[model samples]
Target: MSFLIKNKLGLARTGIIKTAHGNVETPNFAFVATHGFIKSLKEEDYFSLAPELTISNTFHLFVTGKHKEIKKAGGLHKMFPLKNPIMTDSGGFQVFSLGWGKKHNIGKVDKTAKNPACVQPVDKSTRPPARDVSKTTCVAGGVRACLPTGRLEKDRNPVKILSDRVIFTYDGKKFELTPRKSIKIQEDLGADIIFAFDECTSPLHDYEYNKKSLKKTHSWAKECLKAKKKNGQMLYGIVQGGIFENLRKESSSFIGALPFDGFGIGGSFGEKQMEEVIGWALSGLPENKPRHLLGIGAIKDIFIGVGKGIDTFDCVIPTREARHGAVYSMEGRLDIKRGVFEKDKKALDKGCGCFVCSSGIKRKDLRILFKENIPEAQRLATIHNIHFYKKLFGKIREAIDSGKRSNLKKLEKHYKF
Candidate 1:
């Protein structure tokens, strides 16, 4: 399996990723379906919204049943019952093993702006914190973020899963994740594209720690390949070197030379550092192989990523954000439960040209429908966000094919890439 870069705009590119499952088009987006399902969107809905290949989680599945069980059940392809190609993470990235950081919670700064119910609770420190009782926000037309406040934190406790095999602690629990276990799990799941077990470090870590972690990851990746070899399955080597450019260059250069099918840009760079790191990593990477940016799938980020030569990205942003009643559109994003759309008849994106937009579902109708149930609400939001993702990639790829990919930055203001 290999990725062929057919066109280039600066460092950005349009390409094709040939996988055993099938093929994933370049500059594409894959919605995360951890465990067996995507939260609110049905498999049919997903195909309808984007019709692109998708990826699933490996760690979560392992926790429930052994990988051998899945292989007996006819592998992930039969278990998930999908026609498009599928990809799986190596289960080593602490994020998947951990969840959002419940066991040993760290570095989640709270950003609050005028207590909007549409926005989640803001914690000045710690992970996702409690909601501000003083704020009021809406989701859909009239669906207010009207939580009673006393039980929000208890309801949505997030954490990261690790690969150390022992359940590590966070807030107050242990999250034990091991590499061998992850490899076994993904192998049974049998995804077309698999990632190596790499530690996702924080940007605040010192140079020595970063260097040590990267080296460990390299060794672990090699071991992962040895332990979980599968015919037609492709493995990806992650490039991790934190915010230091020299380290990033070295890491990318070294990882690029390895006998891996593709590459993934893992953590160590948060939102602020995302673009710069992509630029540095791609500097020494060969254009022949596919490059993926892990956990980034927003519209603006999509443009920036494509412009910087990322072929694929996977994130729960669309479905997760939509679960909170937020929706993305061509014009921009607005919380569906906000006060502004209470009676608005306009679709989430008037020009979106998707089924949901054409469904003529009123905001008030959606709000009332969701009050009846969260799944119904999540479905509508998922529809809109999926459309947004599909459109972003489609436009970028079109630009690349048309020899105008360089102008993609004009779609947004910040031109970091």
Candidate 2:
């Protein structure tokens, strides 16, 4: 069966993206499993998070080893035994992982995927020559990167600045990325669904630059479609055009028309433009296919997108923020590190039914709790944020089940959306 789109509130959706492992409830949050799974959490640990799905990176897995080995060992399900739907990113996000240093500045890259003008002058003798063609950090006009997120982790240079074309040396080796190589890696990974490769234009791009970049991305998406052939596995095209409404409309229409399993609005569109993007997309695209909004999972954002008809959302804020001691609440968030929380407590939240809130009493405020080195604080904090997310969606699912979709808005105000 297709990934089920069960319910809708405004443009946001409460549904299931069914996969071989299981059905991943939609309009969900993703804890960064960038290193395969959350750092300290285990397979059995998922029950507490109760996440509708898990997301990992195709780029990370390929860099570490082959993903086919994962499938052979029973796909990710057997290796991890999480028993929930998992989604794999195509590693397209690395396209903007900027390389910064005195030697490298951000600018338009050429066909070689190298930015020449980003390099600023440095001491000719002390620093590596600006025109050293043999260096791994230069392409055409000559640029370099400081941070390398795209290449094989082994090939990073401590001093090398990582730019689009130039890679840093890790243990004294450099890594390079070409679009063809990325597509091949994703095809081999064999996830239930994979996104097409596209450059993520940061909000910094101007209209002309973003438009040009989106055109290149559109062409690249076509190339990925031509190169990839995954039977039964779905491929979603990403639409990128910063915040410009016209560019968003153009990119959405173009990508939406492509033959694919789904479409993801991947750009600067935020809560303010959620409905605009959705309304624009729905007008030009087919409704049967799923719509994924990259990096959106806040309470208000969910309602805004769902009301506009978005099917799924993935963001690192929930768990990342939670891990840092920030707890999501109805009114806003609790910055657990603040002094106000030192004496306050009361189970993180009174409205939440999560284990953290249910099992607890007050007294272990931030000061005393951290002073005593309590593990419950971290666990309680994560659980509370997770409950806030679940409760937000539970209401949406209930509204959809009852056919009172409009009620989602009435409840959303309490959450500060």
Clashes of each: 35, 24
Query: lDDT score, residue 29, model 2?
Result: 57
* Best by the lDDT measure: 1
CA lDDT of every candidate? 0.66, 0.60
Give the lDDT of residue 274 in candidate 1: 65
**Candidate 1 local lDDT, 181-235, one digit each (tens):** 6666777787778888777654324466567767767667677767765677778
lDDT of the structure predicted as candidate 1: 0.66
Off by over 4 Å in 2: 7-14, 64-74, 99-173, 178-180, 187-190, 270-274, 281-283, 361-376
- Deviation (Å) of 152 in candidate 2: 24
Mark the regions of model 1 whose C-alpha exceeds 4 Å error after superposition.
66-68, 95-178, 372-374, 413-417
RMSD of 1: 8.0
Per-residue lDDT of candidate 2, residues 1-417 (tens digit): 276667554445567766665566665555556655654454555777667766677766765664667656645555664556666776666544332221233322212222212222222221323333323443244433332333323432233212232233323345554445556665565456678777665433456666777777787788778877556567789888766668777888888899978877775543244556556655555677788777667666777777777777777767777766777766478776777776675666666777666766442554355446576565556656666776777676676556665566567666763
Candidate 2 lDDT (Cα, 0 to 1): 0.60
